[model samples]
Target: MTVSSDRSPVTDAGAPLDGFAVEGSEGSAAADIAIRQLRMLGAASPGPDVAVRGAGRARARAEAGSAGSLVLAADHARVACALDWAGPLALPLEDEPGVQAACGLMHVHGRSSGGPRPLAIDYASAVGGVLSAQGLLAALIGRLRGGAAELVRTSVAQAALISVGQYLAAATASGDERDAPAAPGGPPFTSADGVPFEIETFEAERWERFWSLLGADRAALARGWQPFQHRYAAAVCPLPPELHATAAARVFREAAGAAQAAGISIVRVHGAAGERRRSDAAEPPPWRLTGGSSDTPGPPPAPCRPGAGLPLDGLVVVESTRRVQGPLAGHLLRLLGAEVLRIEPPGGDPLRWVPPTVGTCSARFLALNRGKHVVEADLKTPEGRRQVRELTAGADVFLHNWAPGKAAVFGLDSADLFAVRPGLVYAHASGWGDARQAGAAMGGAEPLGTDFLVQAHSGLGGLVRPRGEEPAPSLMTLTDVLGGLLSAQGVLAGLLARCRGAGGIRVDSALYDGAALLTAAAPSGGARRPRWGPLHPPLRTGDGYLALGPHARSSPDRVARALGADRPAADAAAAVARLCRGDRAADVAERLRGAGLSATPVCTDLADLAADPRIAGALDTGGAAFVRSPWEFTS
Candidate 1:
């Protein structure tokens, strides 16, 4: 559906600007984040005529003829409504017996050394909202080209699936717990000043340097931790707290500094809140308009005939990327009916060899590259560069995630590619934005823009703390997932503008920028951060555990009655422990839910997820089970 022209952009000060505007149906942090991103894209706020409503009801109403391109943003419940699903939204981390079971969060959390609580963040919902917005924009763009208006849907459930898609694929492929190991844990070590720090060494040279810096005994090295993978595996295995404490006896800053100087990555664990960085005002917008007259090849490419199903039908994209972010963007486009050709180096994407292989392909690789065709080309070689340029001539979108200056070096930069295909949507995904911004942010160094480093740089580490403990990085690659979606958003926007007669544009999305947007709703200081802990902590039942939502705190009387306790709210922990000792988790959860409390039994393993009817239908069964992108379109 195409947006009505009445919508316009509005700033925080309430002044309406001249551009497309978006209005949210509900007031939610996730919705706010999505709107902020839209503003960054130069869209204005919607006028009064465009009444934004809950996505669930909107979809139902939309089907009845109010079908214009619509963007729906909400938490999981609203998403469930849009999909016409029964019951509450099954959040992966928020509730027990959630899709986390299918995604392997329970297994990983069980093995974590920190505590029983899983990584606490609404990342799935946040990312889902962003992706949903992107999908809406794509659908709207299609509508502009004469396609029927459609409802583009995304949910925390879908975001949850994307976050753990690789892990779930591995689990399904291996069909054995022992075969699918969790990613490394960035083992915690204590400094001499009693400060704890996490260290990550994913390379053999760096690992050796770390050991050498620590003056490790020869016997320790002989323990067979030479290979990088072995060290990664050893780091994640349960370690004694005392060992970390002893390691922390060294001066924290000094130790970290020394390790870093020797080319190791280390960060001290602290509870300090993340400092907000400057806006993108000094640099170009996350996605910018470029190559208008000087590089134009006349008007935008002619609209192609729409296909039967996907909104992006007949769109051709040439994707030159590896790893998660760029490939994920291409994957999303492919799901929406775009033809994506992944261009890899001679040896293929490095991730092709990542662990938990299904046949010859890594589960992670399979998850991201499922629908696309792939070809090998060395951009450094003249023949290979010529071949890529020839492909660009016929492609509508050119997507890549090369480092800042590598694009120009390889003659694949925006200026170069736009010269080849003046009407192409040139999209670049990176660790940071332009070279100046990235270099400045990294203290004049141009480091590789991997997911973990981007998380640290973007201040995500500061936002999540394990109650009373030091901050930890998200086990889920939150930044990578969001950054990828943002890239896809940029591409969609570019395509829409092109179709509207704007010349070819250059779209840039960075992991750092995406991370900033993820936490934009947070107050600068003194505002109460949402408590990561459950309002009612997990209760131990006879057979398993149950997680109850914080809303139950409002009616302590009801909670007490449901748990069969007289003063459960007074000493809630003890009361729940005493009352649930002999009851089954599923029974307690059902009873609490019946009493109007939000609660569910904690899923213990993949088997529980596989049995869930709601989750099973979403998994692709062609090979090892993996999630398909969460989108449904009607013409």
Candidate 2:
């Protein structure tokens, strides 16, 4: 079913794309793009390729091999295809010849200023896609080191680590997040009137109070009821379906009173929260911001300006996307200097409608669609299909995030796009992929949670399984887009394989997959804390929260004295605030370094941090603040 394009892969075909593109849009060309404009603006593309298609061996070899390679999209519909190696004649794959491809897409979704309407946690998965990219890269690197067929390694650490880094980079870069508001906690929905409700969504309990203020029985007053406590007990009973609502409300009010009265909490439930509002109200981590209100780019950095010049450039990419999952693929690719073009339908990508388009479109949309060219097209239309066929011609990589069984509707199913673009690294992402989680429908229109659905359902919640689900839903999500990032790594590995003399490759990461990756630490390890990766967590200091390291612990030895030690010199202000803040009934800890002991500190304002030159510098465009890919090239 491979559709052959009559173009010169080596020499151009007679208008090879002549019959493939949609009418009226035939004059497009990559050379026509303002690549110079982009590169001048600091957006370089992936550079040269050493692999070239050999003398007619690709098709010939494919015809000879029957023990075809199996491309598994998930645990279900596992595919077995005659995957022929065309690298010697095409692009060098990034990994070995065989692989037991990982199942599912890492759905890392986020609600950028401009993104599709609140797709909820679906966006978390969308954002998580960045991790997929990191993991795949790290994994491919690992594979390149050791040769083994049917084997692939992923960076269990890089997925979450890079994600955290991206967020931190975004926040610290502009020092805006320091002043950003906390995420809004929305209204608490009640089931009709009678059924009681529990505060589960968006840290609701932080605002309101829990209660059980059931009143005492009156009839019993005349007969046997005397004590108000007894009546309250019966009224507050959880077993009675008839009394749940009344019991819940009374408990709510009483708890609310006690909490507020004790200066413990308040209500934050109200409306739809957006990026600006959330960032404005967001409780920034207690770190000094080095940069001020500077949103300016640094002297218009060159494309792929990975400091020393080493970077991935001249890379070609086709993002076959819709909603969050697909666009995120382009997002990660763009970060690394790939020339990523987003193919959309006539009205543009469906996600353009996302309430707050963040990037150049919707706020939410913009947040995820950064770094890409948008082309209006309808794959369903012959012209649209033809255009994609034209645009993707000779592209280096391809990615599509579509729901199960729906890929063909737009001719982007696993086989469609890849067949025509063999050495083109390919990636696919979806919920309940073509594997075991396939067939089952998603809850309502959205798939799942905002930031922690995988935590609520899959990670901690234990929900999605081999196919049985509840009619009643509990959450929304963004973890799936993680597939885009992780998938990037997978695709890169494939490309790398060709470089190392292997065949083509396929990569997948689902919300569930990302969720699975998150559960790395041994559940608390009874007494020991887990590794925090790279640097240790931060701690409360004389002024604010600072990342304590051997620097913090041995500082006393290096600078002065210890806290509880009598007659100690150099008793720095570092541990002053922490000494007095005891954990209610327990003693505080001073351990650091090997233990990675870091405190998250009590909730506080970030005004001080935003004003700190060091913190600002750390997040400034001059340092770790700017969005620069970890790459460089020798001029």
Candidate 3:
């Protein structure tokens, strides 16, 4: 709980993770990376109370009773079958899964890319690792409060499911009205001179103005706004071809200048060299933490309620956030047992009325905001601001994803909130950590901190798409989800510090930071030259596609033997596809699993997810078809 920037305080009583152990599977980088991140944040002391073991050794260590808190990372299918949880219920099942570009991760990338194709880069695996880390942190907080040892488990598939939950929610909603088709198309428009870039603005007028300034077709401008604006929620933005044509007519600088004049933010998609330059630049940590004190201190930390099973039970979080990241963080906190009181604008969140609904609520909105309490408050008014302060006085945490500096405009910043709730764990899930720095990164114009733009600016656009394809950011709200996870993690860490007698703390997590973390972990070469592709694209079968997880690339001979094909030394995708083409996807998947490899039929349709046996137990199909909280808490 010490306030030094250099010290690790993410533990109970500032004690290291004395008995926590991680065992099983070498490529379970998610668990390893999560543990490593925690340790870097001071979860572990000098020596290793946190233990890690390779695959097949978990049984021996469990029997020995030396492994304390344990986290296991495996392929989505194995984890799903063993845990009987729907977890990720990945689209692309694969043999020998890891954080490779294929496997379950491919499904996520494909969703963002407008279909089920492999992302040239690794995203889901790293995200799953972060999810595992959050689970571990929540468990540690529980232990800090004198709860028994907790079991934390996650899979890459589960992580994938969590990321795509919003889409699934809308897709799985029952009733007469079907959600709109996920028609393929989106941004990062390529200019005439061959510079690719993304444009962003939440306001429709700005979008219209920017396009008109660039002499885009007037009819296309009017037709394109809704899809462009809703891309975050819809997972696709099929802009009219005329808009692309317009961008294609201008040079990069001319288009950029027009966008600047129109008050729209635009960023060039960084190539390999640009990605490397950005990667080498210093960036903020995933989440920045700072201690704060109230002139008037609040009561001492409350004791954990007796028999309360969830770590955050009895705590209250007042969440005022629009869009995905902040609300998702609040949702995670709610799942962890905090009573989340959501502050919506007058009337309600407009998104509540958007598209396919489960009852009166937007199924997509419900995906992130199902169980929270709600109160309408117009923050633009003084009374509304006063009401928020009153709510904060009784809350343990105040979380938001407001645009940078908006809080201060309303006098609702951390300093303002600390005045009311002295021990509040204030969290701001931001687009860019600092606008000035972000502006510098984009060469003077402060790029909008939206997901796609962040992806373009942070070198993800190049890495995400495969070679020979147009480089563009995955429009899946990727950084927003990652930012949300980081925000919740920060809140839990702050609360843990408070449980150990620390004062109020402020946590700021940014989409830019999340993008930076992913880029930093990727192999060098940025986007101009991708170092990896889908290790193995989903193999086509008689019935459907079968994914041979990342491990398939490692054990080609075994895979070849299992499929009765030659070892694929070259053209592995075509070879693997040919091997499975004669069999049903299920048959191919089963055969690979029998051969001691991870495999499953690719779940191309979200509507069919509830019926999938591997994860049916974890899904609640009575309403919207969203996966339950990924963590299974067992004391």
Candidate 4:
């Protein structure tokens, strides 16, 4: 089904931002688009529509009138300076190699046997855009509550870092090592008919049952399960070769039949043509905000002010979510000063013991769950649902990531919750929004909407790899990270609507929409595969590799000269590789940076990133290591 233009049901209700101006170079378009999308959702307070202008500092300053405007910038120093003049808000959108490397995203994305290569898509830049929008909403919320202006800052590098926070935590944790080498291996396992597809199952019994039906050896099935399960955290799956051979022995139809019989989910990779067909349809908005059952704003909020606290300070959030997307959303809200109370099943979440622990809990799980409270309850039971409703009664927000209809089955849906807590911001961080209807057009039996599966279905798997490489998901949990950010963005929008005299709001954010955003923002294939060569390509050095940022790619001649090569822009990549073959990656990167280019060593080791001084402030390495919040708020 094609996406509809009816995004936010409350768009016509209010427009708080009378003057919103974005200032920066052409590179700031990603961030600009994010702000505009939020405005489209009616996230602003009651006023005229958001006012957008050109790149000049003077132009932005002049346009931002006394109504308290928000100014976003691409330069960090420029934003810091703007805070003094632009009273309402000042946000920095920076995407540079130094931050990306420090954040360890470069390491995670490029992890493979063939040496580290840059992610084909502009992850840092795209995610930075989403973050910038969130920052604006948060700053606006602060202003509305405290009646004072604030400074909010984030960079592409920080966004990239948060995306890989789980992986970095696992790498630095104690006990058994959970990750395998970055060797080239993992899913989209090919069938005898040459069709590449991915399979997913959260239950080991189902995994065993599916492989057994496909005639895979008992030993292979048992051996492959760990790596397959580890794939999400490790960012690579080194499955036993026997399993690959097993899948290769059967046609796609036969393997699919086996999956159906076993009650597991399977989906073939969406090729370029199929992706083009899907892309032809209108992409869904980042989020959909609908009013709740109540027409009133519910209980009057307690008197609170931003003062010296975060934007969401004094708010309570009840979160019932498993896995990365939901937990990350709650985590982001907590960073914005909300008190998030996590609802886990009885005996706590099983993943808390997945290994590589800090103290008694898994560091990987803690990466996205630090600084949150937990409650034990089983939604399968009536009493458990009652307990959740009781918690939601006093909370400002209720967030969850249950299956499509699971919440309603337990009577914990938006309507049900709104009955108990009128103005609650109910957010469903789903895997796929209306997947059944949408999947019908995509031609499939409706696969489970997991991170890798969404990546494959959205054509991101094909786009993220180098041009000639095989198409497969990055295993970096790309969709989950961005989806989490989108979920938080939706929740903030809901809160903004409620603050503006609108009733309780219901927000729907999905991995599908997040993937659509990433794919839509990506450059066309031709532009990505430029005449000068691959955009932001990684160059191999004597000992390791160095990744060139977009800035460096733009000045190929400078790069060639720094590497002691003389060649036209088209051959600069080859020339640099040849000349830098005997130089250390760090040395080569330093030389390029000295030439006023953007380049950095591809941080293959998480430990190296922890040691990198440039982004030391972004990491909390005491005990359980994890990335800190990307945003730095100041009043």
Candidate 5:
């Protein structure tokens, strides 16, 4: 394979690298993104001697890498083929309008009775490819350092997990309640004069301050809407007539302004009629490597035989992370055959008490943190600090998601740790990229790196909004999941450098960078706004909902036949809708499959997901039925 030595920044006008062709088909957009990232990191040449293959075959190659050169693979359908056990589902390569409709992101809509319409952009596949590429890069780095070649895998289904992880976490907690708690009706509201704006006051103090600023009656607050759960439930359920009237009175820009003055978060909702310019300038590169030199050389480590264990066997990681992102990275590392010891505060991670508890563990905590060792430490104390330093002395990787500078306060920053472990791979996951960016975004105040705030700040809420309606944040914490995966990728890349006898390396990933990548990857122009279109959106069958692709065939009659209806071409949609309305969604789906047309039931709840035979084997029944990591080692 021919490898290019041109190490230059990739731009929109950059030429494609040679010898990096995806095997067995035309290169997919997801592959293109992954290849670009890998090339940028100098892990692989534009023409690396690699062949991308199917997940099943790729798994075998990765397993064999335990005794040989590292094998890196990216399967576009890894999740569907491996995790869901759905065979050979081909996804669109480009970010088309209806791509998300296939996944159910399009089902999220304004409070209207209209048919399901496509969301503006496709995010899952692109993110999946990018993350998969990062994973492969990490493996490649490991291989170069005398480590055995490893297999790196990523799939669209795995990427789609981010869009629903929060919901899945909630589902694991509540058993039957698959939905997360609503955080009040904070969407954009129209003023009496017709100007539109949005406001948020999820915190109790912020809500009280907002009420005080609005001069609302204390009696209104006394009606027992103080707790967030009550407010969240109120937001999801229809408001009573009196409550509606009261809420309707405050739908004005002035109310939003007052709320903002009281330290609440608020913004004017932008329209799709005009091009939306990005508020911040283009962000810096998503990944950075530090403390590695090309001139250094060291004896390669011994290669191990395949099938001994996961690819990361014999690796040691020290993690000081909590909540979703950092813990998630550590979780993946643990699954990949690394020994991860999670260090929690003396009082334990705050997530331990986040409700929907099974005995003492929260569902969120359990879902993100499985198969890892844990310990308690008080970083404020010298002994705790000494303990951490000792742990780092023997660790290959040190991972953390603390607020920017919190590590420095505890003397656990890269500089401090490198003194003890010069060859350590330091990975830092954050809500924002670095202190400068965080300061600029928060006006010099300490920023809370929560997923929701990052979503709003990154303009994702506006991008997903229906036309002429208030922007809504996704119920899923897309950034947190993606950030976690990317952070893991960074750690792997650092490890690769260390294998090359490079000194201590620091890798940085953040929610802001993930969001920016999603935004940047979105197709420019030609986006179909959400609306009821023929062959688009889910159709209501009598017993349930079904999403069918209109572009899958040349004739609408074929669609009618797929739905088991014999009707004229002109009336095909109506006939199919009528026929499906009378039949069970499963039966209709089976019949459509028999006819070779693409179709799927609109899964409305976690129970529906759990009922699937493919998913049944992966559910954890120890407490609530939580989903196991959607990956397996063939070896």
Candidate 6:
């Protein structure tokens, strides 16, 4: 096994580090193993550029002293450790196109051995996207002092979270007991704004808010409305616009300031994109990849075990993108270890103040703009565009959601940027592709709008077909995840080409594209799976959903028997519903799924399952909630 190492020395004498194989060629290990010899200079400002070193070299280094050693290996998508990491180091995920999850190496000196054991920090939450060496090293150091080797997991919608919750619950409880809510590492069923209600101080001759709103209504006062309100109810109180925005912008800050003065952890959480680093320290020097050559890494872990390989690393991405599509690409790329910077137009990305929501943010924006750096630069302006042009020059990858015509106006249509930013990997994410956006050969921006229409046009609704008695299929958040993956995948593949001097731009991700991708799943062996579903054939799992196979290539009787009654009748739905109502959802799900037949009650929200302690116990890492990143970086 070969691994990559950061700028530190090789602790052991196994073999000198080597690079990865190029994308198109293989079989020549000699060229693949050529290490980049350097005159050793200061770190670059562009950020650390990671490359693979044969795993043999990694083993040699891990054997050396347990400090100043940073190991970063690209497994194609998720990075892995060659050996246990043990020192102050900043391990950023590679900024390549396909990478999905980056890892921070954490080494806690073992208490008995008087040395630190390995630990890792997966910063998918509140990610600032600036993986500076100091910042990275600092986080690793903090973890060693007390941080657990956390497992950063990812789940799509409540479905993914529910399965995880059930697993944790089963792992924690003893015989017969089905419920446990206080389990450590479980998510709060409802984590409300912690502090209760507050009185807003007005600039005019005004009294406190609660005193004014309910003081006159003693009836309301009885319900704590006037004063003793359920702190939550008071907090949720709707205020007049003038007073609300004013107090919110200033009053909360003032109150929080006071609390902090008195030693409290009081802070407002902005959207992930707008979130700031815990420390102001400038982005650290980029890692110097002075050793090793080549680009493409090894194979990735199958979906069954995501730990096998990392798809992305050390790829530079500038997303001059917006709305859901562009930001979403940046978000997913961050997971894959891509260095993604979301360059916003002046006054920030239009998303900064879109959807006309409360509190200077949009709910949709918050969810989509995570894991990337948000910077204000108006591309519409000549100067702004020039600045962006400069930024993109060094960027190995670029993505945008603008229509081709409009993007072309700003020098981003197709491979135009490649002229200025040579050998760059580029992609465009759009709701409507050039075909749909065209109007009598006037195919452009004016015609494209509304994600809903995109959904409808792509036959997303048709994909649902119809069941016996259920309503039509609904719009799903999964579209965003899938679309985002498409765009990132394009960029990743482009980087792989560029790494070998074969770079070029490509296009991927459309609302229609996502719909088509889903539609493709309907077929197998070039024949479509019959839409015949009593919703889902009378089976153990019930309506609209069916069980998956054992992968063993044979029908195992053990699975059939464990599924209990194989025949699914109308009565079975009632039975499952009945069990769920009695809090037996966990037990029944486990027992049935244990049989290797796909089973689990459709969870409306992950909240309930997250609260179950049995589920929480299985996740005792830094995953504040039971939901976590799918890959664990164990080299």
- Lowest summed-lDDT stretch of 10 residues in model 2? 96-105
TM-score of 4: 0.87
Off by over 4 Å in 5: 1-29, 43-120, 138-154, 161-166, 172-203, 216-261, 267-284, 294-307, 438-447, 465-470, 525-535, 550-558, 561-576, 633-635
Give the alpha carbon lDDT tens digit for every residue of 219-290 in model 4: 989988987888888887778888999999999999988988998888777654236444454445677777
Q: What does candidate 6 score on TM?
A: 0.45
| Candidate 6 residue runs with Cα over 4 Å from true position | 1-313, 353-366, 436-450, 465-473, 524-583, 590-598, 609-635
CA lDDT of each prediction against the hidden true structure: 0.59, 0.32, 0.69, 0.71, 0.55, 0.34
**Index of the highest-lDDT prediction:** 4
Q: Candidate 1: deviation at residue 524, Å?
A: 5.1
Compose the digit string of candidate 3's lDDT tens values, residues 1-635.
Answer: 01223543332234223233434334444544565556545543323433333323333332232211234322210011012112444333432233232223455456655545665555666676677667766766766666653455555666666778887787778755656776788887999999998888889888888999999888999999988887887677888999999999999999989988889888888754345354444423477667734333466446568887876778899999888888889999998888999999999999898768888878888889989999999999999999999999999999998887899999999989987888888998888788887777678856667888888877777777656766778777778888888889888777866765666788888887677667755665242545444435666779766666656656666677788775554765556667788889788777877887777666677776556665664567757787677776555
Residue 323 lDDT, candidate 6, scale 0-100: 49
Residue-wise C-alpha lDDT for candidate 1, range 1-635, written one tens digit per residue: 01111222111111111235455546444455565656655655545533334444545643342112234332321211122111123432333224333344444444444322444444545665576567666666666666664555555556666766665676566523225343333444657777555555556667555655665554453332432243222214433333344355557766666566767655544332344343321222344444433235445645547554666888899999877789888998998779999898898877787666677777768888987888889898988998899999889999999877788898888878877787788888887666575556544454556555555555566564434555555544667777788788878877766765666677777876666655554454201234543343456779876666656645556776887875437666556666777999778767878787876566555435654665765677654777876776654
Residue 195 C-alpha lDDT in model 2 = 25
**Model 2 lDDT tens row, 600-632:** 221122222223342332222432232223221
Give each prediction's root-mean-square deviation over alpha carbons.
Answer: 6.2, 20.6, 5.5, 5.2, 7.0, 20.3
**TM-score on alpha carbons, each prediction:** 0.82, 0.45, 0.86, 0.87, 0.76, 0.45
Off by over 4 Å in 2: 1-311, 322-325, 347-367, 438-452, 460-482, 501-503, 521-561, 564-626, 630-635
Best by TM-score: 4
Candidate 5's residue-wise lDDT over 117-210, tens digit each?
4444456656656555655544444444334434443445445543454445555564443345432333334555554544455466676666
Backbone clashes, each candidate: 18, 157, 11, 6, 8, 58
State the local distance difference test value for candidate 4.
Answer: 0.71
Cand. 5 TM to true fold: 0.76
